[model samples]
Each structure stands twice: as C-alpha cells, then as structure tokens.
Target: MRPKQVFVANHTSMIDFIILEQMTAFAAIMQKHPGWVGLLQTTILESLGCIWFNRTEVKDRVDASRKFREHAHGDDNNPLLIFSEGTCVNNEYIVMFKKSAFEIDVSVCPVAIKYNKIFVDAFWNSRKQSFTMHLLQLMTSWAVVCDVWYLEPQTIKPDETSIEFAERLMISHRAGLKMVPWDGYLKHSRATIL
Candidate 1:
C-alpha cells in the first residue's frame, strides 16, 4: 500500500466503487444521492471506508476533502480512491475530473476499467432505473467482465498546478483504456464547490 497515493478512476457504475475497493483494498469517496439510494448506500458503504459526500454542495465537498486528508495523511492504512468524474459514463468517453481529488499534493495512480456488456449491461443508470432494479438486472446476467488496469504513479511536477496535473492524469487514463482521445472538457463546472 503506497501511503500518500490517491487512486483516480473513471466512474462507470455504482458497482465501480465496490469493485475498486475489492481490487485495491482502498477506501472510496462516494457522492451522496437522495432517496433510498443514498440511505441504502450510506448504510452499506460507510463501514467500508467510504466517505459520503454531496458533490454539488461546496461545504460537503470541503468537509469530505478534509476527511480525506485526515484519513490519507494520518495513521489510517487505506489509501484514498476517488472516482473523479463525479458521475458514471458509459466508459466510451472520458469526462472532466473533479479537482477535489487533484487538490491533494500526492502521487496520483490512474486506474482504467472497461466492461464487456455481452452478458449484461453493467452500466447503472440511476436516473432511469432504481438501484434494486439495476441489481436484479445484474443478478440475471451470467457474469460481469471488466478489465482493470493500474498505470504508473504520477507525481505532481514542481511547477504544475493541481488542475494541470489532474488533466494530465485524465489523459493518461483515457489512453490506458484505449479510448478516443478526449481533451477533458466538462460540460458543467462545479466552480462553486471548488
């Protein structure tokens, strides 16, 4: 386990966080949703080293970042895992990463995950379907197959800002996944939260 290392990845589904946790034994930063989804996930994931946060709220993001620093820089052994996209995409296109993950001054490890939807569509669309329905669909499938790769650790350059560093790592992760080069432009800005 590399101390002071932030694991960054593209968000594909709700299962993405659990999968990363199982693979790397690292804690994750989860966005707090409303309704049953939030309650259920909080109950299940909070014990698993997840830091529940509201992505749109500035105070929540700030508090979450502080908690991250405490856990990551303190004696706690689990490294910080951030799904920087702040939302799940189909994995074909990479989205702009949230800067909160980049705010930390540490080595960032980029992880790329690709899923084979032949057996089942693993992409969870919370806006369209409920969590239980998604889980039922997954259960009916033969299996979920994904390719997870860990790229080399990237350190912040002496002269580079966190925004630039995050953009660099985002490019690296997109390349690692063999995705069409995305310039890392976010459709929406969370400047208020930043």
Candidate 2:
C-alpha cells in the first residue's frame, strides 16, 4: 500500500466505507449533510478518521482540501479513500468523478466496488429514505455482498490536467465494474435507466 495514495472509487452504499475500513486502515472522505451528521459523529466515523466535506460552500470545500492534504501528508499510516463519484447510485451506473481527489499530488489507486443484493437492496436511496432507514434495511436483510477491487496505482502525467486524470480513472472504474456512464445533471435522476 502506498503511504500517500488516494483511493478513488464509485460510490455504491454507506457500507462501502465500512467494508473498505475493515480491509485496511484508511480515512474516507464523506459529504457532510445535516441529516446524518450527529449519528455519524457519535458513532465510529470520528474514530475511523472520516473527513466530512461540505460541497456547497467554497470555504468548507477549501477547508476540507486542507484537512485532506494534512491527513494525506501526516505521519499516520492510513491511506485516504475518496468516493470521487460524489454520491452513491444504484449499482447500474456510475456518475462522473469529482476532480478534487485527482488534484492531490500523489499516486492514485482506482477502486471498483460492486454490491450483490441477493438478500436486500443495499443501495441507499438518499433522496427517498433517511440514512437511518436505509441502515435499518441493511441490518434486517439476510446478507449484503460486497466486491472490492484495487486496481493499479497511477501517477499523473506532467502534461495531464486533473480532470483528464480523473476521467481516465473513471473509465477504468466503469469498465471494471461493468457500470454504465450516467449523464444526468440532477442528483435525483441517478436511478434513471437509460
């Protein structure tokens, strides 16, 4: 495992972070929303070194970047895991990756995660149900299958922009997961079948 590598992956469920954390000690960057903040803070999130990001405000985003850099550059042994897709979607598709993770001046490890809903639908429909509701759904289910793959680490080419690097990684994730590229601009449209 590279000391300062950023693991970029397609978001599937909240369980994605749990699964990854079980495998290795890594700090996962998550979006900060009012609904689940208290629950997350009181639980293992804080202990696991998760970074809560507020994507709406410029100041918050900047602060998040700084914290991310500090954590990535710190003496801690954990690598950083960033779900560049920005939000979770049904296993059918993957959205365009956010470019922040790609901008990190370090090797990037692209990851692909696929979930099997043999027992229950593990995809957290954040729009319709609350995180707690979805979590209860998962808990009551018979099983949730998680498949994670760590692809090769890549370095940004001197001539390549962060967006280009992110796109390349996105392609790899899509191919690996056999996921369709989602083109909708609206977050609620993520479940749309094309």
Of the candidates shown, which would achieve the greatest lDDT relative to the real structure?
2
Report the C-alpha lDDT of model 1 over 1-194, residue by residue, as the tens digit: 57788888887777877677677567787777788878767787666677877756999978988888777675565777887777777756666677766777677898887777789878876568988999999888889987777888998888987778877875435544434334333333334654
* Candidate 2: segments with Cα more than 4 A from true spot: 35-37, 170-185, 189-194
lDDT by residue (tens digit), candidate 2, 48-93? 6778767678898888889888877666647889888777777867
Q: How many clashes in candidate 1? A: 0
Q: Which ten contiguous residues of candidate 2 have the minimum total lDDT? A: 175-184
Error of 2 at 116 (Å): 1.4
Give lDDT for model 2: 0.76
Spell out the clash pairs found in candidate 1.
Answer: none
lDDT of 2 at 34: 64
Name the TM-score of candidate 2.
Answer: 0.83
lDDT score, residue 151, model 1? Answer: 80
Each candidate's lDDT (Cα)? 0.74, 0.76
